[model samples]
Target: MDEHEQVFQMDTGDYLGDCDYIWAESERERLRRLWLHHAQQLSDFYIKNESYIAAIKVQEKVQELFADAEDNYFILMKLYELLNNSGCR
Candidate 1:
């Protein structure tokens, strides 16, 4: 299994000794929310920077974060289109 799957399979006790289950659950949820928030923030940052070339590069990296799928290709294509529409390299 991948590192992420292995981490998910581990119990609270495996990572945090004597931590309350409720607290662990909250922490996990908070982490997920923060990750998503950060991702959006990063996208906005790129957009505001007006660095279309850099944004395209970042979009390529983001595509790699997902497994091979139609959605992944669509996202990449959309990013490319956005860059092209912006008339930036």
Candidate 2:
């Protein structure tokens, strides 16, 4: 299996101790990844359509949802740049 599957399997294993907490954390991570993936896709579509403000709005929600994600900050900065500069290279 790939690394993520391996890690998930390991984390959920009974011998690891605190299975409930591990499972909850794993599930939260899974949902976070799903949310980030879809949010990025939607934002990309908005950007492609020249809707920078809309894209920024979507990413802002992502930022709030995943505050610890450093990439979210960079994404928002880039989006703001695009909005102000109108497509910076």
Candidate 3:
């Protein structure tokens, strides 16, 4: 048997704590960069495997992830349009 009594933790953070949540510009940039990285990886894989259909789906999802960011709209729209216009749809 152990000498010290075991304890379990349930509360992670205080809901009424004196804390704040701020959405900073740098945080937005970081998230955009992360999503773009995943998009690039998926694009590369699809190109190498000729998985056009699957790639289109994944690309749309990536666009959705960045949908709230107006800056990303044009680029994502272009990609999807390319696939559709390329007779891959």
Best by TM-score: 2
The regions of model 2 sitting more than 4 angstroms off are: 1-22, 87-89
Residue-level lDDT tens digits of model 2 in 1-89: 24432333232222333555755776666765765676787778778888888778778877776788898789889888888897533
Quote the lDDT for 75 in model 1. 51
Candidate 1 regions exceeding 4 Å error are: 1-23, 56-76, 85-89
Model 1 TM-score is 0.43
**TM-score (all chains, Cα) for each model:** 0.43, 0.64, 0.45
Weakest ten-residue segment in model 3 by summed lDDT: 1-10
lDDT of 1 by residue, 20-70 (tens): 586677676566545434444555566677655654554554455434536
User: Could you give me the TM-score of model 2 versus the true structure?
Assistant: 0.64
Most lDDT-accurate candidate: 2
Ranked candidates, highest TM-score first: 2, 3, 1
Clashes of each: 0, 0, 0
Cα lDDT, model 1, residue 60: 56
Query: Cα RMSD (Å) per model?
Result: 9.9, 10.1, 12.8
Between candidates 2 and 3, name the one with more favorable TM-score.
2
- Comparing 1 with 2 on TM-score, the higher-scoring candidate is 2
